[model samples]
Target chain A: MTAMRPDLERTASALFAGAPDWTAIAESGLPRLLVPEAAGGFGGDWGDAEAVLRLAGAAALAQPLAEAMLAARLLADAGVALPAGRVTIAIAQGRVTDGRFTGSAPAVPWGGASDAVLAAVGGELLLLPPGVATPGLSPAGEPRDRLDWQGAAVLAAGRASTSLGKSGVGDSAASEPDLLALAGWARAAQVAGALGAALDLAVDHVNTRVQFGKPLARQQAVQQQLAVLASEVAAAGMASAAAAAALDAGGDCRLALAAAKLRANLAIGRGVAIAHQVHGAIGFTRDYPLQLLTRRLMGWRSEFGSEGAWADRLGALAVARGSAGLWATITG
Target chain B: MVAVFALPPFAFPDDSAALRGDIRAFLARHQPASEPAARANCWAVADPEFSRALGAAGFIGMTWPEAYGGRARSAMARYIILEELLAAGAPVGAHWIADRQTGPLLLRYGSEAQRRRWLPGMAAGEVFACIGLSEPGAGSDLAGVRSRAERVAGGWRLNGQKLWTSGAHHAQVMLALLRSEAGSERQAGLSQFLIPLDTPGITIRPVIDLVGNHDFNEVFFDDVIVPEDALVGVEGDGWRQVTAELAIERSGPERYLSSHALLAALIDSAPQDPAVVRVIGELVAELWTLRQMSMATAAKLAGGEDPVVEAAIVKDLGNSFEQRLPQAIQAVLAADLDGATPLLRCLARLLLVSPSFSLRGGTREVLRGIIARGMGLR
Candidate 1:
């Protein structure tokens, strides 16, 4: 089955293409889309979330759509009530002493705008009310607010609290969702969408913008560059889609997520370069709209985990399997 | 915005696990212990006995109809076996083209009598075939074929030279693509013929590659005559017929799995270096991703959609992975080339042979162009 529902896809395209508002996204019931039907929410899977996150990325949306949906699912898994306002989950490590969080979630997406940040500190998954969020920003200038809830009272804790798969909160019926990898997966989907947007811009640029008496696309040199760019875009899309399916199937979560994130992170370099290069100085302008995609592509590569970080994780897994098990590991 | 290379959700058949186990068992029992480097370029390693044994076991032609001596299995079923054989580095060179494209082409386009005559032998692995698409004059610009076939009395006379005809020395027949109508050009009036290799005035000369291997050859036809039934499909439909199976041709496990043996060897070497581990890990990640792309392409093809662009994406990406793998390994670990170990030898073998990964099926540039055209860049 396709991950994207037709109606949701059409709405997302229109909504993101224009000004994407959190109210519209939450009002459209996107944050609750992954919650089980028994729990007062849509019983959709990660595949659906994958498509939404991709659209959010394509538009380089400033709204915390990925974070909000993930927080809802994390709450659902913990058997907690869905929050009314926008929310995000802290994927970074923090410590809770005397029912107070002392560590800061350095890069909580839109923490100031979110109603609360669901966090797991020292074996307890707690929802911390927003308290004096220190504003930070991603390379795209989107909100990457720092949440430091010093001596803050816990809003709630889940029925079943366990360490989140990444560094911190959630479990599923089949497989536990690694919050860190989940965040990375969200960015990977975003990277894929951003790459697609960049490729489209580059393709359109080459076909229309005349250079040296012909469209840039007419030159073999330019065509070759675009070909490379297209290959990267296709690869990122494949990797993202594959990981989404793997998570849906309850397959190897860590391996699939690592590969997907790495693939997308690696692709951003060539993809962003070719997209901007074809437009020359015109693309470099603030009004060009190409930077909207290229900037996210540049920042998203290091968002969840940089290429090198994921590569290290994969390498350790590979070495643990050893050479004899390499084939089985790959095929399995 | 477009799903140009969008891979659909796919799962292997429920019985594929058992099917894979059986093939693994068969391979373990029958696979001869050949050279370590041989398995790296295993698909080009011709072993007729191994091929015949595999055929007898029903691995060959598993997807064709039972009436044509096939096992009547699904395409995904056959894909499982094909991948198993490739991953294990079995000598599959002999029946690869015949089982993969030529036999399928004949089944779809050849006459009933032609199918009855040729398919059973091919399914049995007793018959081997090579493609005659590329000639001296037609490499990447495949439409510039100079091969000519004339309608001589009672039959057609073929006169042309086919280049890069892999396994021509062992093939029983050549699925030759030639211009049937006089003075036709650029993919027009082209026709395919099932010309027997032993026909009169035919010569097969080996073309040793840089690695000094005899896997490839040049086949010359001097007025070779074949009966009327030899023509596959209607005249002037050869281009369409050939292009029809390209997605399937480029969508197999052979594209990326070729370099698998080398990765296995590296793991076996047991280098504890983190850099080495990282390289191997990166390769595995890339391989895993490529396989997903391939499976998606396969699913699309099985669903009866012609995923030519998707298949090209797989091939170009897969080939680059294959070509980069050896170099990636070499870059991370300093292999003692002079007193080389097994891993180093496999690296060398792959470094020499992996160049053909892109060259085979279609060049990387050509595949990318197909992807570009599919994206409306052309």
Candidate 2:
């Protein structure tokens, strides 16, 4: 019998049901894809990471899985001692130094809300005190806090100059394929979750709502609309899973990941529009989760990058090589 | 082996792979006459031996009941078989209409007499079928069909012309949708009938396609007489029946895989060009996405759900990709062709066949209309 990973399902279901104390779930059940056998982690591969991220996205989790994965990724990149839970690592645009890591990073996930901050001081990893809040920074949600503070505790200090790589992650000297793969899977998963939610909402609404004395679902037109949504969700889901599996297989997943993100962004945007149409006037209000799903979809459309960014990446790839070359790279 | 993208569990059991294997074995054993053209003029082989082979292999009547020598397979299973045949460029043209639409329609709405009379032969691939839907004046506006069928003593008299009838030249019967009553609402007056193509009053004139293939014909029904048993369903229900048939027509992998030969050729004849890698990658991704959507729709259709909207969406996206293939390939080959073009010939072949991608089943605008209506915007 085939079944979904229990840990991922548990974490996602809890988040979807609005579980308040999600951190416990995240700590125990999250980052299963990132934690390795050597570091007391799950020792799971990118396929596991993709599955977890998909569940997380489907559940619309607002937890710290991404942040922790980011931390694990950075630690793995730096080849340093990994920290226990309660550490949060985020990317900033500038450098950090002794007893203080200073830089302006906006819209960090779980930022301003974490117990600790790992800043890339120059090219070296530096741990900063949580109190060193950067003022004028705001959390996108209630669980996050953004602030600006003076010089704070710098965990691994005294690196004269450090440089983050082109991808804006630390460890400039070496490539971080795992971390990049995580970002790709994470973004794809979130889009999957949002798309799944939109489809569910639409299906539920049409099944119950009465139009012309018949349930909307009975109408051929309604059925057709739901079918469209279902197809998009199906495609997006496949793309997400393919991206994850490629990463697990240690193959070049950049093409798969980009395709997944691009498809997700486009599909979810279309899905939300259809959801609203099916839900009618009630879909527009804040009382409904529709607004939240839509906002997150819009946000995630440009989170790691937007549709345009991925399209450009894909287009550039096609232009750099030929169409046949691109197809072979993706399929072959 | 093609890279299999992750998919939702097979929605239903699909024997398409097996179907393909069976069909391939049969095709190999009974290869048709040699054609000077490329690949039997793009799988247009209408050879009787090939058709009889498929019928003998129990590969025909994929979705029909076993009562008429049918298999009672799900649509998804049939989809797999058809897709494999089409993608491999098999000469399935002889029985394409019978297997795809007419047989299923007959099963759904044809009288028991009609089913017993026609389906067994169809299942055996002894009878070829063609569609008489599109007319000289009405292409997309199917409701405006003017092929009038007047009530007669025994059955009816059909007098009108059907344009673009693929396989009509060789078909034994044409399942035609025509207006039975004059001066009524466009849809209310329509009726469908199964008329033998060799009837005295029927004439089929070849209308060669762009590839100079006689696959299509202008089928003219000038006072053609048909028995009452030829009526497909209750008079004035042709619109409904036709719409249902459109669902069968549009919701399949064939809608997207029209250019698959080009895709396969490009991969097969791959040159060691660096830029070719990038372009092929993007095309592969698009094709993969389209396949997923097609598979999902197939699953829904197999579940006895009407996936009209989903089908429209798939057809739309698939057509876009098909039409874009020429541009995508040309962009890559233009620079190289200027230096030393080897694949230009293949690209040219694709360009020649690409226009039908958006035209054959339903035009892009028609699909968009259906999609808009589905979205409740119309």
**Consecutive 10-residue window with the lowest summed lDDT within model 1 chain A:** A160-169
Query: Model 1 Cα RMSD, Å?
Result: 2.9
Q: In order, what DockQ does each candidate have?
A: 0.59, 0.12
Model 2 segments beyond 4 Å from truth?
Answer: A1-183, A192-234, A241-262, A265-332, B1-49, B335-343
What tens-digit string does per-residue lDDT give for candidate 2 at A115-144? 666544333455555654443322224243
Question: Which residue window of length 10 is worst by lDDT in model 2 chain A?
Answer: A158-167
All candidates' lDDT scores? 0.80, 0.66
Clashing pairs in 1: A164-A168, A164-A169, A323-B267
Worst 10 residues of 2 chain B by lDDT: B1-10
Provide the clash count, candidate 2. Answer: 31
Listing every candidate in turn, what is its Cα RMSD in Å to the true structure after a full C-alpha superposition?
Answer: 2.9, 8.9
Q: How well does each candidate superpose onto the true structure, as a TM-score?
A: 0.94, 0.67
